[model samples]
Target chain A: MSDTRTSAGVDNFAVSKKMFTWQVEGERSITILTAGNLATTQSLISLLDERSVSGEERDPSILHQPTMFQVARLVGATLREIIIGASETGQTSADQFGASIIVGGQIKGGKPTVFLVYPEGNFIEITEDTPYFQIGETKYGKPIIVRAYDPKMDFADAIKLLLVSFDSTVKSNLSVGLPFDLQIYETDSFTSDRSKRIQADDPIYQAIATGWGDALRDAFQKLPSYKV
Target chain B: MSDTRTSAGVDNFAVSKKMFTWQVEGERSITILTAGNLATTQSLISLLDERSVSGEERDPSILHQPTMFQVARLVGATLREIIIGASETGQTSADQFGASIIVGGQIKGGKPTVFLVYPEGNFIEITEDTPYFQIGETKYGKPIIVRAYDPKMDFADAIKLLLVSFDSTVKSNLSVGLPFDLQIYETDSFTSDRSKRIQADDPIYQAIATGWGDALRDAFQKLPSYKV
Candidate 1:
């Protein structure tokens, strides 16, 4: 889950789109969640789009990558190139072009993979020890995920976990806010079973936020009281 | 609460102090929690100590400040001055002098207040709308506080709340480790009733962390799972 809210110096909705996907029917499927400067991320995405659309042979587009690792490499390289170009053109410092992305999915017969691409053009793939990865303002919502993660967790439970995570982040930080873009791609499936935007007033979102808050309070009360 | 663990490319135990307190019998009491850089914070604290001990009478030391507001101002100014000096001496850039602090306590005949002092020598006080303040890796621990805070909460409950908050933070970030310094000052008492360091194997810390994790898993199970 990723929120649509974006802000600059003052509160303004300059950009909202932060989720993307590309699929080749039954051959491949991919999903990406992005965070950081809008212009830099958008440019990176646009570059990928332009490259894939050219349909030229030997293009380093994500669509043409043979494995998920290569896809991560292509994305990381494109992001770094955009940032370096921005710096060279006096757009901003390389550090000022800060952005991070979480890309996950399966491509054809390859096992599913998720990778977090960093600003330095280096990347790390999620492993069994760290089965899930988060980008952007990840800390606020991370505690619950760390405590409750299960390797065999079902899609429904995963969405609940993510919603609770996103909701906590939205409440604590202004940079990330409501109406998240959500997608779920089942293993071996070339398409997501669900892909939609969760609006502020969405019933499930409301329920999860309220339910989680109440449940936390209840759990807190159950803990042994501090010795006076 | 703050952890004692430290890291610089790798984890080690070079610094552990993260909390401090000062008191004037039957007059005022204050506690501070610091985060960011060790050098800047230690220098800032040392400056305050030197000024207070010099007895120059004109020194704007935090110990001599009549009100908590003035105390905050003095601390902020001291921190800013140290940062500026560090920059001027080619130690690092102004931004590289990054640090932040949380100061909270009550003065004689005054209601308790908490202030978050910024690196820029400016500060903001805690309000009824935001009753608590946190410094250093606050996001991982913030959701619990946001949900659990209450003006009328008892001292024991409040301590429980902070422990839970701190535990969550310690579990998620290696940079914020344990052997946390804890202190509690009740209203009208110029001295704390409880103050101690919680070691790595401290039963209370371990119990809270384990019990809270179990409670969260239980809570997750109770939430109506999303339909596939």
Candidate 2:
């Protein structure tokens, strides 16, 4: 899942897509979530897409990577190329070109997995012990996930957990907001379930957001009051 | 209230005091909370103390600042002086000497108030609309405060609220932990109640910490599950 809000400054936020998906029927599926400088991330996504569809190219494309590891490296290398290219023109410092990405999905021979790719062109794969990666405005939302995550939980439960996490972040931060883009890819499915763009007025989201506040207040009151 | 855990790096954290108070019976009471570069903050505190007790100095000290606003400015100016001095000595960049402070208290003629002092020698007073300021590791703890804060809440309820906020932060962050320094100064009283340093194994602290987790999980579970 990814939030659609992006901003150049605190006061000027616009809805912008930050998730990209690629699927080859019965073969592989890939989903990418991005956070950081809008221009840099957009450029990275465009380049990845162009390379995948471009014919007669010597450069390896994300679609052709043999493993998820290679796909993550490709994304990182592409990020570095974009940063170095911008730096060479002296348009901005390489540091200003930073972006973070979470890439995940099934790729034929590989089981479903996710990788957190850094701006420095390195990545770490998700593990059972740490099965999730969050890229932006993460702190407010993290406590719930850390406390509630279960590897055995169903996707519906996972989505509820995420909505609660997202609700917390959305309420606390101005930079993250609705509508959120969500997709679910079961292992070996090679294609996602009907992806969702949950808008601001979505009933379920409103329920979760408003319901959570009341529920939390009730829980807080139930806790023993602090004694002097 | 302020946490005692301080860290030079993620792997090396030590218990250190970050709250300072000055109380003069039936006259004035002040509390200062510090967050950021430990060495710089320590130096800032020492300098403020020295200037206050120097006896023959012309410069106004924290103890002598006539108003809470002036105290905030003094703290900001001292921080700027420390950063500039460090820069001039070629010890480190001015940016590395950054620190943030929250100063609050009641003076002889003024109503009780709080101010957030920035590293750049500027500050803003808290108002009814935004009655609290948090300096470091603030995000995880902020949502609770934003949700539950009530100016009319009694001192005990306020402390309970703060403990809940602190509990959320300590659970989420490695660099913030018990024991916490707490002081309560009632308006027009000009004297604080007995302060407490809540240690990790303190019974009340333990009960709240463990109890909050259980309460949160129960609250989360009770929220309506997401519908497909």
Give the TM-score of each candidate: 0.93, 0.96
What's the lDDT for residue A200 in model 1? 81
The C-alpha stretches of model 2 lying farther than 4 A from their native spots are A90-92, B90-92
Root-mean-square deviation of candidate 2: 1.5
Q: Tens digits of per-residue lDDT for model 2 on A68-149?
A: 8889999999998887777788876788878899999888988999999988889999987888999978999987787777
Query: Residue A30: error of model 1 in Å?
Result: 2.4
Question: Which pairs clash (backbone N, Cα, C closer than 3 Å) in model 2?
Answer: none
Error of 1 at A58 (Å): 5.6
Per-candidate clashes come to 4, 0
Reported per model, the fraction of native interface contacts reproduced equals 0.64, 0.58
- What DockQ does candidate 1 score? 0.71
In the predicted model 1, the residue pairs found to clash are B3-B177, B3-B178, B4-B177, B4-B178
